[model samples]
Target: GDPGLHHLILDVTQNGVTDHYQLLLGVRRDLPDRLLHVEIGGTSGDPGLREGPDVPEAHLYDAAHDPDLTRILLDDLAAEASVGPLRFRHTAGAGIRTDLTSLPITAEQSNTSLLFGDAYICKLFRRLSTGVNLDLEVNLALTRGDCTHVPAVLGWIELEPGRGARAGGNGEPVTLALLSDYLHTGADGWSLAIASVRDWFAHTPPAGDDEWAELDASAAGGDFAAEAERLGAATAEVHRALADAFGVTTLPAAEVHAMAARMNAELTGTCRAVPGLAPHAKALTGAFLDLAAQAGPLPVQRVHGDYHLGQVLRTESGWTLLDFEGEPARTQHERRALAHPLRDVAGMLRSFEYAARYLIAKSGTVPPEPGGRLETRAHAWAARNRAAFCRGYAAAGGADPAAHSVLIRAFEFEKAIYEVRYEAQNRPAWLPVPLTSLAHLAT
Candidate 1:
């Protein structure tokens, strides 16, 4: 019987750029005030304007995927034999788990009901791979490896029953969502970054303030370096674990150079769109080329496809990662592209720049540091973390640090160029986040 998932509650808000359908849903009370709660895209279209998330990625009863093979699945779900008053899947993580056959096939478009309880996070897959899904794969790996920081894989539902966890299901897993213990999280990477920058803006160091306190208090005395160091180490472990699972190969000089060429071309065009990013773009691209030219290319590993602080969680237990969706917009091939692990390092470094500038923009005032200090600080922090990340990375290295350093710098430049376009389109106020990198790159 379908897990009786009855009574869906929905509440949604408009997307930032357009009132268009980016319908977002999340536990309102469980989240911070500034966090933009979202439903990934239940129904994400103007309706009159276009198609969207609220509509469901794939039909509920996909013949190719769904096990019961019909809408009957929904009915069977509601009608599951009753186990007294308790919901059949009541033990399921978060939200209302209903007996499918009981009442109706209800599909919620939005709700405040979720906001009333612990957050129920749904893992939305950008690319559904063959075999055991990566979510299940990682959970299994974590369990086998005895990793504790990651969310426990309480259980997962086979949205398309026959499709998931089945030998015959091959390439058809209905990667809907998983049932893991919800993260009663203290903060996400972005939130912490915003908090850290707020402190910096207030003339306080990241380590001076208590991050767990009231926002104002944290700003008065912020201290994020410890967290930063921990995050770096955690990321290293994650990569090491991944490498243990999937072996790595050394990158070819031709392949590394090819990527550098693509990056350079991308920056050339991207910088022109926003003059502010031009100087930074040039420098960033130059650094990467310089590194590649010298290093003869390093070994390639199965690195985090889209690694970044935003992809992490910060808890007392330590920092952890969420989402293996990879670049979100890139092709599966691109996301899985093997290069210097520095690609991940560079991504995190870019995030610091993103975070620092994002808070300043939100506050509508620049940091107190004048002249090159702001850029210098951005560089210092990025350099510190990059170095810290490298220290851990070096331990796992197939190559030495001095040689990998050049390759990493190049990736950092490449990542920054992507940021320039991202900021120009989505956050003009933060266009400088990438622009800042571009500026540093230019000089």
Candidate 2:
């Protein structure tokens, strides 16, 4: 073990469940020791450790929250030093510097992002998994290709496995952090979409007309059609760049059948976990079965596996996509597997549906009638944006996503099913959002 570096385990208990976290501390002679990073580590059930906090170990300051500690980390990155088991790799031609202030972004859920002045942002992965992180891999490829739709990748930190108590039990190194150009004024697509929905809901019809019938999303002040179209175009551009960077391949008909089979298996498991999905199982299964029956080879490529409104930002220049790391619940192998680009398109379309219905669900505004006024307006908004996005995608030289109706519909159903399970467990009130989507698809 290094003299100034220590690996400490912190256990936090909430609701009778204890979770373990590994904290990497860097000690200095005259200054406070800094918490270099934290990750989810292996659990220990030793009862003796539960009684007291270890001396000095619990007194470390977070590098992300403190400017001094952040500067130390930056200095190491600028030097491109291999500190203990961590290796810093600065991108070629990157102007690495250390004289910058740091501000920790608090809104991130799965990872911590530290903003350096106004120029760069560094994202620290909290979960240690083997292999190159998909986000880092895709960003680097796009940045090197000079893609304007994504932030430029600057550098990254990688941790060698089988080092000290933090060993991930594999020989391959795992990505610890990624540094990239920051978008200071870029607003997240989710916030923008919600505001659009709110504006639409707040609209007042002219006098002497049927208010509900006359209300139109396009007529609303915060209409998102133009942005949605541009976003679609940007998404297409990203897909093209990814195809060029990673190389595209075709999935033979036999493999497509296997893919469909995997989707069916996922559906079965989801149905078992969420009994509410059982009634729609038969109809939902039809989508996968139809996917299997398709003939000829299907084109597949690296894609934004977890594409959604939240994964994009609307900047002054244009839409900037973020987070290429697929669904977190999936294994590394699954996240890296090549898939149809339409899967991403489907995810974005589903995201529009979510944006439209989320407010209605939160406010308990759904009318007793099946096709009530609010419900109708929500559907109209989602439909308009979805159409605009597809139009932009086609106009940007990509194949018309709508032309591949079978594949898109199946992918939508697959995403909706995953959402059904997610919302069921975490957001019971929001369950209707995906449930309604499944019901529409089931029919």
Candidate 3:
């Protein structure tokens, strides 16, 4: 059976003139179930096949182990030829550019990342957007600023609609793929933190060793306080560089109140959506409201909206930050908005708590006393690292995140509420991770 009429109407505004165009896609019974072939402008272009229905029918380009597709795209760009409605553009740095090499391509949630034989990693964004891509823009800015905390940009692929074809208004070019330096030896921060926690949890204090029992997180064999501090310093350095690159703005009280209002709304909705959050709603709301009554204006700048252990990497030099795309679920407009730097600080703090609680929940051993002994150790580890991170941040050129305790607490509470919903929908068994953080925040 042929899949019925698929009509895609795009309103294109070019040269101050707006016009509507339609694309009709009819299924080919002979093709695979996941494939979609496009037809537009009363002429059937190449029946380019796509694997998934979720993927956009137009702009179907795949370079995974297919040297032919790579050559086609590159040749199209070189010859300025139009392959159906898709147009290709490429840019190179000052150095000589390398020819396309066949390598493995890995698909992430929102994009496809390909390794170009250790020379570069090319990320092809799954979804299309009208404006400039943040990943490319941020990497370019950071590289120009000589910020060593991020990878250098190599080149990218930009796409624009062909003659009479309309995707977004104005027929403006959109970044479809980004090429950048790949860190071969870098280990993600989350994996390192998890390993450290597992190692520390497996260790047993010697018999009758009262000193070892009383020792805190810093004295443990897998103590992460030093690394946490260094990561903190690196975070602060990146924040400083971002501020210098993109000028900072002052957030007024009205904006603060509006942010609090949004937090309250989200908490209210989450409490209704997840029955487990009902008990802590009042306390969390109190924290959110506290942000509104703050004394003065807060400093705002472009920030990594979703700062977590997974977003950073620990390389030989130090902590290197990656993925400036902010939250994957957020809109491009929302992700680009200026925010308080402490928001990122708060996010990192919440990440530490998550790592600790996750380890404790996954641990097989349980103490006989049943008085939350494992939970206590996890909390201690989190607290020590949190404090060390704050100290290092202050030692760097940034203000102490602890100084804005109310704001940080509010952000942490908000993040926990979000995690609660995420776990409820995705991993119900891990619901305890965020719930524990909510319980502590309530206190």
Candidate 4:
């Protein structure tokens, strides 16, 4: 039986120059489907004055999304007024306020975060965690380091000691949401890559055009190699900024072996969850074992734990990296842990393969044979872009990811297995995408 979590409303506050929507203990289990849903609501009174449980269920669950609530909160925060114990702070320091009426509200991704008109985007940390939000932390760090690859952070919402209690004992201030400048002219890297792939394939020779049958990817009008190279360069710059901001470390052999073991465990778990990948498990073991044996002189540092095409944006300036929240499934500590920089490189490389394959599927034309012209075209495009990206990365003062083939391959396989598990559970139709990589990399 599948179950889900649902939302429950808790309390609402309306006071002089301040309106706060407080959602505490609002998570309930939907047993029928086995899915967890976040609940949201508030009683029409002063919750702070008379409190039973400020946050319910021994852990805080903030999953309510109401534009009206956000508007009132922003209005009060911009005024810099103390709405009970909750204080609104911004990078601007003082007297910076946002008007709810002036800014239109737009929802993003299941309505977890919101856009305040065209000027600002507010990201609410739905599943409440005790520590400082990694997104806010990373953004502020990058911004302070003058890293132009990320959007500027404008402000954030925080709940102080007396407002409401969080998971950890003492009521430490918990970050609720972060406000950042919206990129009006920015485009997602994934869509851009997909479009490039479509453009490259557009000139493919029709069925019997033997003369133009196999056009080299470099010769294609929509070649994305240059863009990919530039993006790689941008990525390297960001990595350098991160290294500067948070000093780098070297993972000893023991830790490297441990990392490889974790990869093996992840692969095993993925295989258990997705039986389709079971056949390739044997083939994949060698990569992990080799990684464990050959582990040495690994440079580790804080990285964009969840780097992919979708995590990047292309603006007039250049490639802008976004989302430093790391992997959502992992804890904040794990996400903040230092690791090989090649992890991100591997993720981007996989993204290239995904874009090429997705475009091929969308074209809805297959070659006559199994490993025919279509397959070759897709591989060639991905390979060309992947190579260009590595070249650019190496040129930009980073170790070549390809130089650590075994480690990179293991990381790619780990990422693919994770995707396989995700697809099998959430989107079965997308299972083939990662499965294709699984088979190719397993050998």
Candidate 5:
């Protein structure tokens, strides 16, 4: 092997504990090797090199961010070439140049995305899973269906299963990365919403109750009502495309009851995990009970399992949704399973609540003294945007989310329960955000 970029799978042992790791290293013939990146769980399902005294200490190198290496990788994919155990798959469409410079998008948490000269973005999955990734699968489907709400899928990279080693116990290739057209002018919905909230907050003075009562989100300069509505429409369009591509199904009464039971079980488990939720558990459980009582069959189809403000982008043309992988904490089978589209609507509504109250949460202050001016303005902002979003969804040929109040409320409670567990374990400070929502539901 020549000195350049290399990917190694290693079984590292420390203090009698062993773990698999994937390391992307930069190597040189005459100089010390460099470690570009490392993933805790190695993508390779095969046994790898064991750590020993002979292991070498490597220097650091940024291989994915290197323009030359990125170009080479793109060229390989364009040529449909197999380099070692890796296979490149390119979609037939517009040709992507291999001469562009590449830089890493640093804001990502679960994956690494490299932007290539504003023309394309390549997302490299950190953890490898058998079967095609949901993001790649859904994006490709949307692209084939001519859905304009998503960026075009250029191609993807995969790791071929090694001989005599079934990929993660199944004889399937593992998806490594996805390449897509980059929206150069796209602004993320989160940033836009935060700015809108900031503007609204500035307009709202920290004054007496009378002045706060007059504060209106629509009157604020950075009102997000219009954008939120358009986003809703765009979301409906994408859902339609998904339903067309991957057929829809109806969950019968039994299944619907089972779904509600699952939600109840989750709520109970979460309350047990976080005792602060105990006071509101009885009230929250009623939403699920109402859901279980529905006699009608409910429609289910592929949905953006994890929909939120951060998952959307506002470009010059309109709203573009990103990341179809769903909730990262869920199993692959669960994420791929069909669910009610209102599940996504509920996710977005919860996001509106987060955006409206995030500034207050960030300030480390108690939730605006429970009905103070700040609290009033936050509620108004969230309510306005939530209504606008539902209006846009209904206007765009989708069922009005508000029309299915029972399902919507149940889903929102389910999402909030998940959030409660997550914040309690990871971020105690942010726990108040979901707690506040739970309180409102309880009342």
Candidate 6:
């Protein structure tokens, strides 16, 4: 059955003279008359944060305040929903919070759920791509593989509206959002991980007289060795499932070099924007390109483009991977491209770095450099867990260590460059992370 339409969107594009646009809406495919009714805005484009629904028919009013446009979309959804005015709603715009800084979730995390909370999450992709999201495809594959750490995929929804990207270069249904069961998180991987880090620092003696934090070397509580190993083991399992399901092969040097070049250009751009980061940025990007030159006969398989602690959850049984969705900011195409397993590893390491900075930033005591003090802990944590994640991946996918090691290091450098760009753009206060990270690369 088609996804029941609850919301409608008419991308309003107009010159100064005439303002008109057709509204695309969600509807029950079977029902013709019924529409999902949801109350969103009053007059201005702005609506309150919390939304409420009056009935199943969610309407979309035009900018000029045309109630008829809302009615038309509602009718379309009702027709599509087919369950006879089924109780459902599709929101056009989920109100953004001004002080969302208080929330642990980021703008990127909530993009899908906020609109599809009642029934399903249908992502309306901006940049076009064909077929299904790999996160959706791979996760389904893993669940099909019956891997315990991965969640079971219910199903997938693609735009049967057909290949629109080829026709007029616009206007067709796309594989917008892949819906899955949202994991009810108890404790995030970051908190659980840092607990181990704190325990380690607590046991180890301070390096100097001014040192206040403890340094415990105990692997039992803070060591993260066992868990890291377990994580590695699980990652290996995921990779194994991926290989059996997708198989592995060597990528052409040109393709690898192209990717490496893109990464280098991006990193150099980041450094150029911030003179402070020029030195390390140059070295890191330079090393990343140099390493990319080393690739040959290495296998490329389906990989979690963005794998990290925050992307996973720990339950009573073990660690469960979350969000098959790659970096939300990336295009669906980029997310789907086959790459080194190290891409995921680098992402996890970066995740650790993010967690460390977040902990300190939360305390209002920002680290002078990223990974300077807290990363000391994060590096320990990441290194330990990375090995664990690898063990898991190797066992599961049988990844070659020699090839994987090189690929992973290049990925790590890539992630750092990404961080450098990200921090410089949004949290300039947190730019220290990429700065210090670049220094490590140079040394």
Cα TM-score per model: 0.64, 0.85, 0.78, 0.79, 0.88, 0.68
In candidate 6, stretches whose alpha carbon ends up further than 4 angstroms from where it belongs are: 1-5, 10-39, 42-110, 114-131, 156-158, 163-173, 176-186, 198-223, 363-379, 391-404
Q: Residue 43 lDDT in model 1?
A: 21
Off by over 4 Å in 1: 1-120, 124-140, 158-170, 204-220, 295-297, 363-403
lDDT of 1 by residue, 55-115 (tens): 3221111121121222222232234323222122212232333322111112332211111
lDDT of 3 by residue, 107-144 (tens): 34566676766666767665555545788778778888
User: CA shift at 276, candidate 3, in angstroms?
Assistant: 0.9
lDDT of 5 at 12: 63
Task: Please give the TM-score that candidate 6 achieves against the real structure.
Answer: 0.68
Q: How well does candidate 3 score on lDDT at residue 319?
A: 89
lDDT order, best first, reads: 5, 2, 4, 3, 6, 1
Model-by-model lDDT, in order?
A: 0.52, 0.79, 0.70, 0.71, 0.80, 0.54
TM-score, model 1 to reference: 0.64
lDDT of 2: 0.79
Greater lDDT among 3 and 4 belongs to 4
Candidate 5 lDDT over residue span 1-443, tens digit each: 23357765445669995433344554332332222342222212322331344534333344665565567778987888898888898888757678888888878488878998889999987665556789999999999999999999999987776621333415666677899999999999999998998888777464567766766688889999999999999999999999999989998989889999999999889988999988888888998999988847988999999999999999999999999998988888889889989999999999999988898889743335555556677888888899999999889988887689899999999999999998999889999888876665566
Q: Write the per-residue lDDT of candidate 4 for residues 39-154, one digit (tens) a residue.
A: 33333243452235553322122423334335665675676555555667777543444664333244344225666667777776655555466788888888888899999887
True-vs-predicted CA distance for residue 401, candidate 4, Å: 1.2
Distance from true location, Cα of 396 in model 2, Å: 1.1
The CA lDDT at 284 in model 5 is: 83
Displacement of the residue 351 alpha carbon in candidate 1, Å: 1.1
lDDT by residue (1-443, candidate 6, tens digit) is 13322322234445653221222333231232323233232312333311433323323321112222323323433233322322222222322222111111224543333222223222333333444545666776787677777755543333444333331123434443343444554356867777775565445445663452332334445566576666666666676677788898898877787777887887778777877867676566666667677845556888888787876777667777766667755765777777767677668767756654455555544434333555565455545565565665566555545455566667877787777777778788788765655554456
Give candidate 2 misplaced runs (Cα > 4 Å): 1-58, 161-170, 205-215, 364-371
